[model samples]
Target chain A: MAPPEKIELKKQAQQLIEQYDNFLFDCDGVIWLDEKLIPGVLETIEHLESQGKRFAFVTNNSSKSRDTYIEKFHRLGFKGIGKHLIYPTCYAAASYLKEHLKVPAGAKVWVLGDHGIETELKELGYIPVGGSDPRLDDEFHPQHDLLKVDPDVRAVVVGSTKAFNYMRIATTLQYLLHENKSLPFIGTNIDRSYPGPEGLILPAGGSVVNYMSYTSNRDFIDVGKPSKRLLETILEQRDFDKSKTLMIGDTMYTDIKFGNDGQLGGESGGSLLVLSGGTKLKDLHHLIENPASLQDGPSLIPLKYIESFGHIIHLLSN
Target chain B: MAPPEKIELKKQAQQLIEQYDNFLFDCDGVIWLDEKLIPGVLETIEHLESQGKRFAFVTNNSSKSRDTYIEKFHRLGFKGIGKHLIYPTCYAAASYLKEHLKVPAGAKVWVLGDHGIETELKELGYIPVGGSDPRLDDEFHPQHDLLKVDPDVRAVVVGSTKAFNYMRIATTLQYLLHENKSLPFIGTNIDRSYPGPEGLILPAGGSVVNYMSYTSNRDFIDVGKPSKRLLETILEQRDFDKSKTLMIGDTMYTDIKFGNDGQLGGESGGSLLVLSGGTKLKDLHHLIENPASLQDGPSLIPLKYIESFGHIIHLLSN
Candidate 1:
């Protein structure tokens, strides 16, 4: 297969700012990294705001609440983004459960994530269980056979967590495998590895869910980026023209694939790849040399490529 | 495919005691059920002994050590059997590690079963860890991520245990997935369910091992019936004419299959199915009706079918 042809938005340079009305931005590597603002991110968002463009921040981290994320945004000098515009994967999971699964309102959702997800489940009118509850476990002396099992648990939701243990997994298995096989087994994302401090990589949600899924031979529903379920969740709240709306991110597999996969719903998708966060030109060159090796990116290349979000300024009419 | 045809020894009315010098017996259903001796079992064994036939008990239950099994034998009126004639799956697992995996004699085995297996590991000069060390765990306060991992641990052995919990599994995954992928992961048996009191079924060794095997995506070397590895372990210490040895048991899937699988090394294998302990002739008729449905059984049928072990006495010569 021929390598995807990428159109440099700066080279074409004609009404580039006029193409998209609603903009979806990936948070990590694009807007900021390690609690620091990346160069040109603030000015680009300010430009989008002046053009009356609709934008939202999308992230797969389910550790914190949307309010916390927005607070981080302000703390890191990002202006014009609000809590409503911040779409954390926890919210996506909550929305996906409510809108798609339509689980009974008062039913309990057994969670295996941080407080962020627990808060979402509660705000969304579901009883949440098994997250950071000191009463739920003992230090290396868990009596798993004495677990408090509730047959009314409607779903098992998992994400990144430090408190993951056998009691929770055994309880989830009891709920999913023995008690009720139809209960939704879900996770925020399927990322196997995530960045930790000092170049150390920590295991993410996928590692936690692997044993659960492997035991039952059941696949979990991932509601994070590249799944398009998150996009569906965002679109469910408001209207957007998929043909004109743009998804901009630093990653290829998730962010760009999210844009490309967004097109699969019978519309064209706009994607902008930024080098400041994830992909290098050489990575794209490798993809171009062996397009078939692309694990997650869509068939089409990003419509624009730049060194950072700051470079989008050069493509504008300002 | 044609269904296997059985040749009842009574049809020939010949001296059955003249056929084999070594006899291997599956204990659970063959000699006894629970603590009660099965009818005719005593007489059949007495007849075998009078004829100078050497017999041994083979069982998949790893919850008890060989000495414990022998104590049960003597306590239940089997006076001829000794500790050397008892081959428990726990012992087989120990032998497999030493003979097959060739794990260093001084290395730790890291068991996930009961003290019975722990005893066997120690007796064989390998250190055992993580079975029921109360100091290694606190009641409901398991810190799985903080587990103290030993670098010198050579193998992880799992068997049926009521104490199977998350800390052991987490530690095992840490060793198998992160520490060393080449480490041999072995289990004692493949029995998913075992008989319990008042006809209640119990989750057995296979259930505990399933999660470990599933997490590793690696098949465990099972040292129990139907696996043929246990038989190899028993043969490691003693030599027998495979063509002249007979395996007698209640279940067709494990015992008959064990006998049949034993012949895979290019020798004649003998098997006897007893109705007093397990599957009736009607079940065999059902299998014959749908021959393709036989799951773990081999292509060969039992050499004879009897109502109980006592029936074997009638075939013996004066």
Candidate 2:
């Protein structure tokens, strides 16, 4: 396969803007790092909006609900970005239980994440338990009541949580192993880490998800980026033309593989790589050099590369 | 291979005792469960001692140092069980640093476990850091001082810890990923879960070690059971003849494999599977029926099956 084309020239940026009518973005690295928005990202989004292009913010972060995300977007100067324009893994997990797994409404769902998953499960008419409960903060005890499997829990959803303690983990394992491991285990993502505030590389939701998966000795349904089911759900829900949409992300395996494997962007190809997040140019080059290192090696290679998504506006203006 | 021979008769039990002069016992499930001693186990050990047989306790639990283990042994009414006879993985990790890796004395070792690992590392003349630190108990903060990797830390040791939280995980990750993942990563064991008090299956050290390994995308050196290096270390240190040794445990993958792969008991074979702790007759039957289920299929199967290690005493007396 050919190397990803560099999008540094003004005409290249223009062509990119004209080629795709819809964009699916990975939140952490593509749009912003933590609470700080990347420079010129707003301007680029404004440029796309001025041109009538549509987009939605897709994040692997499951700690915050859509309502909290709207507040963050609004605080970051994104105008009129409503809940519909956001897609966090917490919502994906809840919807997966409801839509894909056909779990009945009002069924209890076990959670090992933060408040976002609890709020989203509740919004979907499911009672969330074992998440953000004050009792989980207690020290580890073998006789803890929460360690017993609650027969009412219809499914298990695990995602990112800062409150990752032995109490929470031991309790969650009971459900995963309950009924001969029949529970539907949903994992938010497979990302190892994310670029955090102050250039710190922080543990991401995938680490927590993988931790549970490893401990339980069971495979989990990944509902985050690169999961074709998640992509098809988003595309169908938004009514976006797959041939005209593009995936923009900072990571290769999750973002680029999502676009490439989904067969996005018709003849032009779909995925665009950016260096503003966890991935740098050197990392891309190394992947290109060692495609066989990954299982689906060639699929993770993006079609085009840029300094950052925000750099699109800089290229256009210059 | 044929299914393991059942040792339920008096003659078979006496013949087994005469066959092996040395025994390696797994602490959990085989001898005791938590603080309670399994009935008849003490009498069985006394019988072995009266016959001039040698034995050692090899536990995957890395949360307690050998000194602490000696105290536990005394508390449980066992006489003369000293530090040299107990081989916990915390000591294995510290000794591996000092002997195998040849990490110099006075070097700092990063720890992601409990006071046991710290105590063991300190005993080996290595300064232990990032373990049982009060600051690690603090809530998640990106700017936490411990997040910064200490340059002097030579290796990272990860084991089981009930106080597992984001702070310890994040800080350990920096060391694991430091210098382009150059640091040696040592994992205490690979036991997924252990039988705890109240018949609860608690998450073991392997889960924590695997979590870090998955998050860092790096392989760690196993310092616990089934690691040939650890088996060799015990045999060489104790001067036990492998041909006359038997490994008794409830777990198949760790304890049984340790004996079988090490070629214990020579032609008579090694590894005595007990049904008292974790594995049941059904689990052993399932494994026997489907040997292809494991990577090293037949090696995981034990040479003999018993109701419990303590049952041998009952059979001999009857």
Candidate 3:
């Protein structure tokens, strides 16, 4: 189709702002990176709050806990966002194991991840074990003898970790593969890489998952974004009306295509793409030229396009 | 599309033996795994030797050097095999940097592998730097700081490492991404996992290479088997008429598909799939039902079914 009409996008944003009561916004690239906020972000949030629009910061980065996000948001001048802010870590891990294996309450989980994954598994009534305490000076200490097969351990839930050891990972894979218990493997997300202060860092969680799957000779279930489970959880929590709800983000691979197919629940859906981060304008052109690249999911059609959140807010007001 | 008759394979092998005096055999599920030889292996070799056949063992496993393979083969009662046996580690490092980046001789290479890689890089005039010396009890010390970009460094060659550290890997990736003059990232092989005495172990070279690609936002050129360059090198060394030669192996993915038309430089090809190793008899039946899975590859046909080397020898002799 023709390039999305800007005028129509502005009109739709205006209508959505007037109608929707709650808005879920993605962090990382959407609002701020590290300590710096994206330009015009503060004003847009203030404007939305003035019009009584509720917003929650949702992120797929499981390295940090929700408390960490709250602290970071406040430090970056985003105040009033609470600890209940949505993150896919816990939900992803829970749904992942639950779907593939019979992980009942109190099932033992060997977790190699941060607080988000640890807390989520614990809350789900699963006995969480393993993983390193980041506070330790010798972070490389073998936290768990992953090679030693544990009959009680029902699953291995991998999230983000700074202390990724190849030997430990290999050992864990050995148990996961050879053990007759049929222990399932769960990956929080499959985002091959993540944006880091030093450009892009190896997202260890995905690598661990990749290693496990490759070694075990089986594929694990990814419960994070782009997989429909996280979105479904959000929709369930919000009781979102499918016909009217809109999913807004910058990446076509995750946000737009994910929202298009009612993966976020509900029968009808829409998406907004901002040319801000991750998937670039050139990528969009490439995708358009080769539609087959997107056969796994829906072709992206942004309901709105804006250079910054200020433009979105300005259009909403007008 | 009927399965190629056993008579056809015998005719093809006979032609190859007659035409080309030199033959190259791949080990690990090809000739033998641990101690036992593959079915029909000894008799086939005896028949070829009787016909004055010459062959060398070629393996992608760089964990053990040529001497190790020679020793292992000698123990397995394979007489007269020598050190000319080729492995991919050295060649992979040599050709990858030379062809892709034109890396000059004596440039420092951050080697994340064994002696095979180090020896090969040294041969190519690359000063193997980085990675820890296990004999010295050095705990994964990197040769250079990742934060300070080194312009003179040639490339990062990932091979198998006994001491695989995440921090070192992350740091190496950081240098490759931010510094190092956009050097070529090379992987010796892409076998995700390998069977070890303890069970399946993580193929660290493949893992590190994949992780670097993800973290550095770059794709690596793989040098081992199933890759076009390795296949071409093997074909060149053999000097066999491709139309007449038959590629036989138990693994359908790498061995059989390597000889298929879709593979790089795989113009003239024939393949025989055995039911002994990677691909099972059941899996072949499954693929036969789903023809789409076999597209862009050779026609996979069942060969003379045998359980052991003795059975294969008995059948072939008869």
DockQ, per-model, please? 0.09, 0.82, 0.30
Highest lDDT model number: 2
In angstroms, the error of model 1 at B300 is 14
Question: How displaced is residue A171 in candidate 1, in Å?
Answer: 4.6
lDDT of 2 by residue, A65-178 (tens): 999999998999999998988899999999999899999998999999999999999999999999999999999888889998889999999999989999999999999989
State, as a TM-score between 0 and 1, how close model 2 is to the true structure.
0.98
When 1 and 2 are scored with lDDT, the better candidate is: 2
Over A29-67, each residue of candidate 1 has an lDDT whose tens digit, in order, gives 788765667777787788878888888888887878897
Best-fitting candidate, measured by DockQ? 2
For B43-130, candidate 1 gives per-residue lDDT tens digits of 8788778778777788888879988887898898888577788888888888888988888899987777887788888888999877
User: Would you list the clashing residue pairs of candidate 3?
Assistant: B39-B308, B39-B309, B106-B125
Task: List the candidate 1 regions with Cα displacement exceeding 4 Å.
Answer: A1-97, A108-118, A128-174, A177-210, A213-231, A234-318, B1-93, B108-118, B128-174, B177-228, B235-318
lDDT of 2 by residue, B1-318 (tens): 888999999999999999999999998898889999998998999999999999999999999999999998889888998789999999999999999999999999999999899999999899999999899999888888999889999999999998999999999999999999999999999989988898888788899999899888899999999999999999999999999999999999999999999999998798999999988899899899999987887998999999999999999999
How well is each residue in A1-318 modelled by candidate 3, as lDDT tens digits? 455434336676676566556666666657765566777778878888888766555566666766667788789787787776566565567656665465788787877666777777766688876665433223222343445666788888776665566545665665566554267777776555544453444444566566556545577767765667666666666666555555666666656666665533233335666665555667666776776765653347555555655467666656
- Candidate 1 chain B: minimum summed lDDT over ten consecutive residues — where? B137-146
